[model samples]
Target: MRISALAAEAGLPVATVKYYLREGLLQPGTATSATQASYDEHHLRRLRLVRALTGPVGLSVQQARSVLQLVDEPGDDLYSTLGRAVGALPPDGAEPAGADDPYPRARAALEALGQVYDPEFAAVAQLEGALAAADDAGMPITPERLARYGSAAADLAAYDLERMPPEPHAAVEYTVLGTALYEPVLLALRRLAHQDAAVRRLGREA
Candidate 1:
């Protein structure tokens, strides 16, 4: 397809496609002449994925680039590819915490959860970073509570992984897309559950 047709097929503006090409988000089309190029189906698919990541998934250009780079690298197992995708997100912007941070105590709390986790994982860093932030705000969470949350989150992950398809790339795509899209859905459900609990425990007879 020509650039115009490629943009039309991808539901993107021609200028935007060119911008993505220049930004390395989209590959350059096949050179057909001095001023003409032809894109293919792969480019179309990639453009859509790029839009999805930047649009609903809310990744910045650099972050999306990292995720796409991981996707482009073949030979990663589905699980590791998904990890790379999630890890590309910017951290919580709190100061970088180390293995021995007294404030959040997240490392100790995570250890107490009884699961071996990579301390270097970006998600772990963000979690522990948020814990440190909470501690700094004078609302330190007890290890017991952190354990509860961690266990529940593990359960959620299990459910997610168990339901994934067997195809490796499909599994990777589903994991990345589901994790980004369903977080708010999960939070909303939690909020509703909280409301129900509140009413059950504290509501007056009416």
Candidate 2:
């Protein structure tokens, strides 16, 4: 397949495909002549991944590149590779809290749930930031509530990991893609569940 065919198969424009090639987001196809090259299924698959990153996943080109880099060169340690991939996700832009930090609260909550995590992990910092904000808003998450949420999240994580690919690169791609694509579905389900619970428990007629 030529670049045109590849782009057509990917549902992207030829110019966009060339742009990706130029940006190193898509690898150049095999050279067949002075200016012609042929692409294969691997190229098509990568193009789709690139589209997902830049389109629905809404990552910048650089962020997408970082993720692809991780998939390309996954290290020996699976934990580290996955950790870096998760860290590449867009954050809430909350810097670490200071002396009055709510990080201790987050750490304590995780400890109570028997969750072993890196203190320096992006999600740990995200949790701390969220806790601090909630405290400031006078709606702090109680330890009991944290435990409930943590339990559900743990189950969800286990469910996700159960279906992870065995190969290293495929595993990394699966984790990253699953996190990005399915997060919105999870959030929507949560909101819908909230509505259903409200209706069921509050005697609301709807």
User: Which candidate number would show the highest lDDT if scored against the true structure?
Assistant: 2
Q: Judge candidate 2 at residue 33 and give its lDDT.
A: 100
My TM-score estimates for the predictions, one after another, are 0.75, 0.92
lDDT of each: 0.79, 0.88
Which residue segments of model 1 deviate by more than 4 Å? 29-41, 76-81, 93-104, 165-168, 195-206
What tens digits encode model 1's per-residue C-alpha lDDT throughout 75-187? Answer: 55666677777776544534454446532455577678876666655676677777777889999887778878988999998999899877766666676778888887999
CA displacement after TM-score superposition, residue 196 of candidate 1 (Å): 5.0
Q: What is the lDDT, from 0 to 100, of the residue 127 in candidate 1?
A: 71
Error in Å for residue 140 of model 1? 2.9
For residue 43, what is the lDDT in candidate 2? 97
Q: Kindly list the per-residue Cα lDDT of model 2 for residues 111-193, writing each as its tens digit.
A: 88898855667788787777878999999998888889988898999999999999999999999999989999999999999
**How close is each model in CA RMSD to the real structure?**
3.6, 2.1
Span of ten consecutive residues with least summed lDDT in model 1: 95-104
Clashing pairs in 1: none
